[model samples]
Target: MNTTPDSIRHVALSTVRLPLAVPISDAKVFTGRQKPMTEVIFLFAEITTEQGHEGLGFSYSKRAGGPAQYAHAREVAEGLIGHDPSDIAKIYTQLLWAGASVGRSGVATQALAAIDVALHDLKAKRAGLPLAKLLGSHRDSVRTYNTSGGFLNASIEEVKDNATRSLEAGIGGIKIKVGLPDTAEDLRRVAAVREHIGPDVPLMVDANQQWDRTTALRMGRALEEFDLTWIEEPLDAYDVEGHARLTRSLDTPIATGEMLASVAEHERLIDERACDIIQPDCPRVGGITQFTRLLTLADRAGLDLAPHFAMEIHLHLAATYPREPWVEHFDWLDPLFNETLETRDGRMILPERPGLGVTFSDQARAWTTDAVEFGIR
Candidate 1:
């Protein structure tokens, strides 16, 4: 096993689209209204090495606009064929800039994200090390906070019940959705959840960009009694000035950047002090390459880095950067992968296996209806 640079031979990219239909729990609705059973789609990326090792990565997206994502994955994969899979940063930048004509952010970044994760997995497999080691190991565990275990659409009893279950499960903190019909209702929900979790456990609220500046400020003021850990995306993602104003006006730290697509946007947020925490998602922020850069920017700005989602990948990044407070927890999409990461007592144990230490399950791949293999030549 001569694991030298020359041992890396070839790379290929392929996609499998998994279709799912799941019920929205009482605690997971938007605007206090529960929608009917909705279809969820997940995209999987497979990267192969000449040495016969392979790795898988995935992204979760709503079903309505999935074809666009599939197309974007194919377009980005075109640039990955025949390249050295070990060069994660180089390949990431190629796909990132390739779609510059269409815009560097959004779908382009997501496409790059999937490929980047897979390539890292491939590299890890080659080196016989875990992704955390490949990324620069620090702590073997990362803290996690519950997301959407408490819903705005649920009754007060239901909300409390779910919050209780989440806390009992060992989650250090819980995040609830707010900003539905009115600010008053939002305040009530936050207060109820806070009481359910008690004073010791941390609580956070995500508005999902549902409120304007005035309403956000008003709600932020009202939520003060509940002792929120952070107020997430209370205003439009692009409204940097409004975020800055909201940050200054509120006692709670304003948190955002999940919707951001590039390091430059994150830098702008940091430069303006628009948020106390920067949440860059691997799939949304141009993959690990950009995410590492964003962490650097956060370090420079004296800000905290709490990645948006993709806990498995975020765990590696969090371990790499000990300053990150927490990684979001959502288990809905875990089954779609071949190998899944585990969380115990509110802490994620970094995968010690090489690469991502996870693979797509056969059942998960069976759910993929449209399978497209790129770079067939």
Candidate 2:
């Protein structure tokens, strides 16, 4: 086989094993849930060009079942070997169709998403441009919201305290978790938080798929007096009709789709007017390439794009999209990464460095144990 510096050469994939305890506090959970500790699995892909430039990307598996996620990543990696790292879209399309028989959504798409991100990272590095600039330079800074310090297990007082602290930290917006033992009690907690934060600061609430449509509508109406920014995932994630009903009945906007796996699902939600704001998690969606497409879809539909998590990637997407209001910030897993995403005055500055502009620290690597590498050509 012949290879040139600018030509497709070899691709290597590896798994960096890192374990995270239950209750990812600073986002949701206050008292910290009991045992059955959770481990975060990161799928890292290194794409090498004939020129010797290597690009890196990562995927996370945080569910109770790990075998399936591991297998999915490995299978996708096999298809990515020998593909040009610069052809990010082509590779993504190939992996997307490779799993077509099983459907191009869910774990399969998520697996592909990780690989796509790594390829984009590599492509950006080769081009010597930040991912945001490569995508489209719309803004130099991206606004952010605090997803930490919400603590579902914390007492009302403690929740208030955390909210106050986040405000003091200069976050323009804050998200809190609801849907507890009783709807009435949940409303009370939300009301107390609203009172503490005052009316000027934007407030969003997430139910984490805990309530049904009726409950969501009732709660939405009840919380109208408090002026919530949005009610997220109030029903099952796949329940587009339920979300539409809730959106129609409530004064507050309905926000869902973080669990969504494809643009098709998002199109359905947007076409139906089910959600006012679209929240796509880069890892859960199909990475940056697809995310840029999704942003376009939302823009045409006149909907807002506020990414779910992965602030590092979201910051870039938000900076490129221009209409994205905020990127959710939760620092639980950041320690495992090499670089920390900077946030100040409720905004994040898009890194000027090439590619994703972030690296995984040795300290973060210490969290890894067993490893698996793939994509050798």
Candidate 3:
């Protein structure tokens, strides 16, 4: 390892599994299983420079397989040693091709996402600036919509109560899960929640890619009266043609892309005019560098930004988004991190602390199932 403080000397990967306080469900909750636990994996990466400065980053999985992602992260870290922490793009390219045989998405990109995020965190920390400031701040805080209260498993009354509580907490936007077995029941839920939240509060719904083109159109059209912000993942994630057709048919915008893996795929979505709101997840999309490319593309296309999970990471990215951004709120992650995300008047305030500005909780550390490190001794 180089003696210089800026040189990359070591990388560490740690894996932790967190169980959802409530077993959250969407339309596709049971892809095959009759029942499943709502647990997720948090894979964290810390890239340390020779001077003892460390940059933190992480990725997550709703499904099982933390070990596989951790293994891939370790493999990616091996090739990153000896490079400058500032070589994010170069290192990103190297890791991108290294996992090409496994395709550009999935576990490989999840690993690369960790590296890219940590590198950016490292860079921003070295500059001693908030990530958004380092990336060029566009807004003080981004608007946030609460999704934690609207899970499918909750009753209609529970849904209304959740919405009311969100409003009481100063959050003005709320999202709920739709695509229930009965369309009427789904409409009823939407109606009840909308009524509870009132006319001005923005409401959004997600089908979790459970519907085909026809059903998405029919249900989306019916639910339009509720004045939704957007209908997310109404069709399959890859059904660009279907999404375009639905997007054109509906007055309510169709938002998707959380399942998407690369900038190329996002380009296809944008080029096809698949949806009005582009929802990209940073860890799922190969980290901030790739996400920023999509953010720029979305901006040029006149599309809105509403990134999916991991609000801690997206809060900074969205704060600097060229357009006003809507970040989803999932309090499910509160137990996983050291810091609390400050929210006021329906918006999230970014932390001024250096880098990603948060660390794993000691309780979260106790959940670590596997840990590994790579670099010079």
Which candidate number would show the highest TM-score if scored against the true structure? 3
lDDT of 1 by residue, 1-377 (tens): 66644323333434445433344442224544446335566566786655566877766554344556667877767676667677777777777677778888777677667777777777777778888787786688887888756555467787688777766776678888887756677777777777767897888888878788888998888888888889999988999999999988888999999887788888889999999988888777767777888887788788877788778788888888757568788776666665666667777778777777776777776766676665432
C-alpha local distance difference test of each model: 0.74, 0.74, 0.86
Q: Give the lDDT of residue 52 in candidate 3.
A: 73
Give lDDT tens digits, candidate 3, residues 1-377. 34454778888889888888877777776343335457889899888887777888998888765677788878768888888888889999898887778888778888788889999998888888989999998997889999888888888888888888877776769999987767788888888888877889999999888787788889988988988999999988999999999988989988999998788989999999999999999998889988988888999999999999899899999998888889898888898788988889988888889988888789888888888888864
TM-score for each candidate, following the candidate numbering:
0.90, 0.89, 0.96
TM-score, candidate 2, is 0.89
Q: What is residue 32's positional error in candidate 3, in angstroms?
A: 5.5
Best prediction by lDDT: 3
